[model samples]
Target: MNNSLDQESSRVNFYIRNWLLGILFIISVVGLVALIAPPNTNDSMGYHMPRVMHWIQNQSVRHFPTNYTAQLFLSPWSTFTILHFQILSGSDRFANLVQWFAMIGSIIGVSLIAKQLGANRYGQAFTSVFCATIPMGILQGSSTQNDYTVAFWLVCLVYYILLSLQDETGKHYVLPIGVSLALATFAKPTAYLYSFPFLLWLFIVKVKLLRWQIYQPALQLAMLVFAVNGFHWVRNFQVFRNPLGTSPDYIIYTNRAFSIPIVISNIIKNLALDISTPVPSVNRLLLNVISGIHELIGADINDPRTSSSNFQLNSLINQEDLAGNAIHLLLIFTAIAILGLSWKKKNFNYSLLNYILCIIAGFIVFCMLLAWTPFHTRLHLSLFVLSSAFVGAVLSKQWSLKVVNLVATILLISSLFWLFFNETRPLVANSNLLKTGRVENLFIKSRTYWYFVGRPYFRESMIGATKFIKSQQCTDIGISFNKLDIYEYPLWVLLNADTDKKYRIQHVAVKNVSEVKQNLEPFKRFNPCIIFDSSGIIFEKIPEQKGNYEQKWFLSPVSVLVKTKN
Candidate 1:
């Protein structure tokens, strides 16, 4: 019996050692990709890093005139961290690390949550491996996107809530809960939806233990929240007359109405995102079933009122912005079914069961309140992260070692494609790296590389445009872009705006909801000798003169550099 017990211990240690090595390899690859790739993501180029640049230029986080109102209005906790890193490093070299660190933190946080849920050492190892292999998490982990960051904070919040419940001493976790909640709230709007039910659960648990000591902790919680978000809230109120900064974009992503049919429609459409397969026929069949369900419920699947845009079920994608976690979702459903079948058992842990139910409630709240967009899969990161604890707890009990190892192996295998073949930042290309430059200068130095990979011409066009601007000896340049979705960061990098203090790049002739709000700032006298336009149409007016722009150089039809003439 003693020999058998020792052998069992040795086997568990060996399995855990192998699992840890696998997780290490997975994160190392993801981190290597992140270190090699620049911030070339759509949202990062369009608004995320652009806003950081604007704040750096203005030396404040105040609202500025811009075509993309999202830069001004989106909750900015993640970018706030990015801005500090950029300033510290004196470059955007560390931009993607913000999400990479979040990815790491999320893995550690989930493992802790699993332990709290009664998972053994092997179970905790499995939890870390599972989280590290989530396709969407792996893809976003290497980008400057905030889905992973927000998911990290939410995981911290859930873990602390679990700790507070299990702690006999009350109010010990109040500060962590407060800090995590504030950060998550300011990270993204989706954090609110994903965090609602768990927060409610915390509140209910805390209220049952109400006492005189709770008041101080409660006050500490409020003050901590305000300390984190108060300045941004004041700025929003000053600009938008609403502390929330509910821009038109926000309304489009929000559900316009609350009805049973709308809720059911949203739930189905949102779930279908994860259920999607790479096969076109499978996608069509799934889409048809969703449409049929919507029709039966007397709701339109593509209702503009509740849809961000035209809705289509996406196929398997390696892109961070739209990748589906089909394998993980399947595992979650399997774990749920397993839990349900054994829920009546005498030895089951009800605490872990209740926690899983709260996360499900959060998902239900999300579907009921938010519109169905193809990118909702990325927003579902928090839900997926929280479910790892459940999966860990279920697999830790009764399941044989072979079954658990098999699931972990499957996840790691499925994750390889995403690791190597990311849509924008592929690691196995002909050149093997996205940027074209020296080995040390791949991410550190600028080249005529693809800032937007899909638009290959953007590289040469932006380089040529910047050279033209330099030749004209213009320090004060004006940017007038027609669309909000255009890439603006390449312009900054190409011009060496970070190192050269003489360059003053400002948005001129801005006409948007933010135009009137930009008035709050004392206007600077900006008269550009040259204006850059992405639309190929120059501005008709400058500061004082009825300035007409003559096309000086054209690198591409879309990238036009024009000189202002009175």
Candidate 2:
């Protein structure tokens, strides 16, 4: 009796010390990395940040009609629905700082998820730190974007639902999971992508747990998850006529074509395309066959762009951000090693939930986000985290063999050290604040996801010009570009928004030279009191005039014109 009591006490002490040290490390890294600003992602800068700013100013949720694809995140879309947290107080400094806490919080979430999923001490430690090391997670977490935010909640909700499923008595069951599901789905509509895997995992778990008759418990968990996540749906319906107003329709445009086989094949192919340099054997014949069945799921079923030939072959080998990639590669290896080493659990009951969790979670995520999933390491960060814990479990199980354990441990340590020691400089450098020239720099210098050639850019110059127009003490302000926040900042950030007229804005979509002319002629009619025109646009207003209007040119092809209606 004394021996048994001592064993229990020892276990308690071990957890206490482990938790304290692990938390300290998590806090330190998240704080240190938080110093940087969001890296350059045109879409993020153009829409997400601005959208949050608008929500802050308006204090209400509304659709963006002015934006061409304004309906995209129709219901509540902006950087995967971080609008909730971003809407908290609307302080730039605070939001930026939130980036730090969120990163650490994600590590905490990952650790908790691992433990709840039956991960042991080593499993928890490996999963938590490995999450920090992945280059994509580190890079995105360092930025102000919402992918990592979405990732954190996604993992947390899944873990919590499983916890609810743990009860044989159907306790606080569905309420917790329901609320969590609501939060997750609201965070990113992509959360719906998990439906298949989530439901699949539930069924699998139910089958396994039926010996204890946990059916009521499962039902309750499901109900609660639905309830918590239902608001997003309600609001989405109000705005877009759909519960989840923001997603593929506005972005992917599957109406033109849908291919199940291509989606399935590319689901696997894209994984390789995202991680490796060499194009794994082109399943050209398969793609051709899948093309016929696009509606069902095809092979060449490229979703981002309409054509399969659009793949940027040159970029596959040109991953320039050495530090980021080094971190990416090292983290991937460590996760694999950890999984390899932790693969064993003497008791199957303790391991069942996590096993089903990994399989279901991994499948849903890969499938739903498949076509839109980035082809770079940073884009694949969430997968790395999910895969790592499973990897850790596998590693632990396999490590029972003496030689295998040593080898796995050494590889894991080496990859981790390489990530932390060698590549720390790039990701955490100067907050990567999405400055003017940094977009191109990130492309040429850093092997980050931003290097992709087609991404958009927004500059402080645009904001500066907007301020100049607003300060003229004019009646109404008009702009020719789509980015409202680009010009709305200095005034909104510096001036009083209660002035009734924050500023009226307009923009034209320029597809070609002809569209450019058609876009400017209307601006001439509105005669934006002070025309903000760029040199690139066709305008009669003096490009260098000191007269009634200001012609502002930003990015390369796009410019804003402000002129009076008089």
Candidate 3:
């Protein structure tokens, strides 16, 4: 009878462990699904992943074109964040898979952060659930957007930071912390500023500056991180002859305020429009209401209404996203309440809150500097992870720890609901979010070409474009797309997917369509057999009639030109 009881006891423990693992497994799946689903999140499809593809093809991690992916160059840290994507999976489909797993890494990292903060298993699990379920986190993670990865690295950084703080006399923690921050920066240029917090914490809580010796190791770690990440810079400088990978045209051209009033207003506006906490941007509210009215009066849900800029927008949900936001707000505020109540007494972990605040401040300020546009939650996803995890830790009060776990369970269930229903996607079979401007339209269509071929979100769509290049047997291919910003990543994917085959595909990079004449004069000199072209956006120096070329490749809004003379 004792033996039988032992077997039953062992079974119970095994069942419970598997059950918890099962729950986390489901949350991870939610993270992956969010990435592969709609909106392409960010103009990301046209950005970095394409660079990853290019690096793979070139057999070196460098900028293929400085002008082509200047923003990525500007945000130097992002290069290392997705470098693995170039190595393992150059296809849009594979990138999607990589993103999914990266998200899982993020979730795992989040769990570790909670654990290091002295939270128990229940606390760690709840925080991970919160990160996975919050509408904005889910929304951002669901796409191939960079913010999700940023959050992942940030969580890892914070966890290691906490671990470092707890370490009494070792400098080893410093290296890991610096490396994580360096990587976090690549995921978002804004992360370059996050270093302020870690340094502050190291000086204030850990090293205390009483000993000047730690500074040397710390400085060395920082330098190593920069040295490792500097290859992308070298590549960009070599190509663009400039160190920065990004452009400031959006802010420069907008004529929007960059002055004191504007900067302060931007910071206030960014915090005010917090999605996890229940506030919406003017665009989002107007969008939701308009989408609701359309749904009530016969418009399709998936292809909802576009921006009031006057096209239809894709409905990102079956409902207003307000309920999801409300629950998160309560959790956040309650967490804040707990933190405030326990600020002096909560001795669970190190008192590095001040330094974290410093980092958060730096990150927020940096984002504000770039704030000609409204702040979207996706851009702020990493902050949300930090804030939410702290709150989750607070709410996992000793007496109510079970309640915290229960609420997290419910959120996990909700995430599963969205995953299956994904009310955000079109009710019809295939759908996409359309961007503004003619060039953006062509970029969207070229992406749509990939979407129709089964790559789900914008990032995956890039991998789809790469697959397109791989299928083409010709090596000497030349392409002229209207806008570099929108197609930079796609170009990277196409060029990198197969570099060994020797397809001399030249992306005719010129400032304007007027420069297309100058850009193509060389191609004409070389006499390329086929030149791929895209046209929902116009990039023409001479009339189509004046160009002595035959159209050979058809991408619909895109085409290929066979040059008769070089």
Candidate 4:
């Protein structure tokens, strides 16, 4: 019996080692891609990187007048991370790696959370593998998006909260819990919805922790959150009249109606989003079923009041914004079903159950408040990441060693497709090496080549405009984009704004809600010798300026307005 027990322990150790090795390999590959790729996701191009550029240009994180109000008001913690790196490095070269580091941290953090739920070495390491392989996590792990960063902080928050609940000797976790809360809150608004239930669960579990001897930690937590978010909140209130910055953009994304039917419709659609697959027929079938359920409940499938965007079952692309974790979703459902059906046979684990309950509540809260957008899979990243811990704990208890290994293998195999072929920043199909036959293809210097690989027309327009401005020896350039989601960061990059301090780009014609602040210095005093207008709005002269700024060149969607003294 003693010999057999030793062998069993040795086997588990070997499996743990293997799992850890697989996780490291995945991380290394994704980290390489993250380091190689330029930040070019639609949202990154639209506002994420653009906001960082503005903050760098202005030397402050204050609200700025522009067509994209999101760049002004969205949480700044993620950009804060980017800004720190950019300022220290003197370029945006390290931007994508921010999310990459978050991915690594989240993987490790979830394993700790798993251990707190009574998982042994094998189970804890398994949690790391599970997180490392999430399709959405893998896709966003290599981009400049905040989802993974917020997910990392939330993972730390959940782990620290559990530690505080379980700790009997001292209050070491209090500081970390507070810090994680502050960081997560400052990272994204979705953190509020996701963190609420877990915090409530912690309070319910230990109400005495709020008393005199321990109340200091709670107060510290509150102070930390306030300290991290206070300045930004004040700025938002001063500009938008709401600390949360409730603009028409946010209002439209919020569900306009509140009813059980709308909630149910949202819940179903949101869950279905995670299970979306690459097969068009299967996606259509899923859509039909979702639509049928909505009809039965007397709700519109594509209700503008309920959906933030046109509802579509898209599964063709493996985009960071749209990739869903179908394999992990199936694994989670299987674990839940097994645990529910067999709980009577197994010992009751209240901690795991409470954790799962809180996650479920978080999901319901998310569906209740926010309108369904196709990119919601990205928003659901935290919930998916938290679910990884639950899946690890439950599966470790229910499945045998062989079955656990099989599941892990399946997850790792399925994730490789996304890891190599991410739609925006691919490692394989990009073929940058063969085309250039140089090391630059996989480095920061080759960013422009990789950034413009697919969007040739947009690339041509931006590059052409930048070259034209340089030829005319213009330093102060004006830019106008009609849409809020236009690509503006590439212009700054192409013009060498980071390296050359001579280039100064400003919003030429401001007409958005953010324009209320245009009376301020930069907006008021920005005069340009030339303008790049992607808005396609032709004008005889620059707005609010008197001159013969005739349209000299038209390049597809972009037009050049050169100022001429008459």
The number of the candidate with the highest TM-score is 4
Which pairs of residues clash in candidate 4, taking residues 3 or more apart in a chain or in different chains? none
The regions of model 1 sitting more than 4 angstroms off are 211-216, 249-251, 430-448, 497-501, 517-523, 536-548, 555-566
TM-score of each model, paired residue for residue:
0.92, 0.65, 0.70, 0.93
What lDDT score is found at residue 264 in candidate 4?
A: 92
Q: lDDT (CA) for every model shown?
A: 0.79, 0.46, 0.51, 0.82
- Candidate 3 vs candidate 4: which has greater TM-score? 4
Candidate 1 local lDDT, 1-566, one digit each (tens):
99999998898898888888888888998899888778888889888998998899889888887766778888898899999998998788889998999999999999999999999998998999889999889989889999999999999988998999889865468879999988988888777777788877767777778855557767887898789888888877776777777655534767888889888888888888887776778889988887888888999888988898776866547777778888888888888888889979989788877888998898889988787788888888888988988898788775887789888888878788888777767775422243463232234334336465645667777777887787666787777665634678878887874345467676766666677744565435665667777764444424443345566777664444455544
Q: Which candidate has the top score in lDDT?
A: 4
In each prediction, how many residue pairs overlap at the backbone (N, C-alpha, C within less than 3 A)? Answer: 0, 61, 27, 0
lDDT of 3 by residue, 335-421 (tens): 655566656673734342553365457655654455323334445556666765565556665436446546766776666544444
Model 1, position 521, has a per-residue lDDT of 56
List the candidate 3 regions with Cα displacement exceeding 4 Å: 1-22, 25-44, 71-92, 139-143, 170-172, 238-242, 248-264, 276-326, 342-363, 372-375, 421-475, 484-502, 512-527, 535-546, 550-556
Say what the RMSD of model 4 is. Answer: 3.3
The TM-score, computed over Cα atoms with residue i paired to residue i, of candidate 2 is: 0.65
lDDT of 3 at 37: 41
In candidate 1, list every pair of residues with a backbone clash: none
Q: Tell me the deviation in Å of residue 529 in model 4.
A: 1.8
Q: What TM-score does candidate 3 reach?
A: 0.70
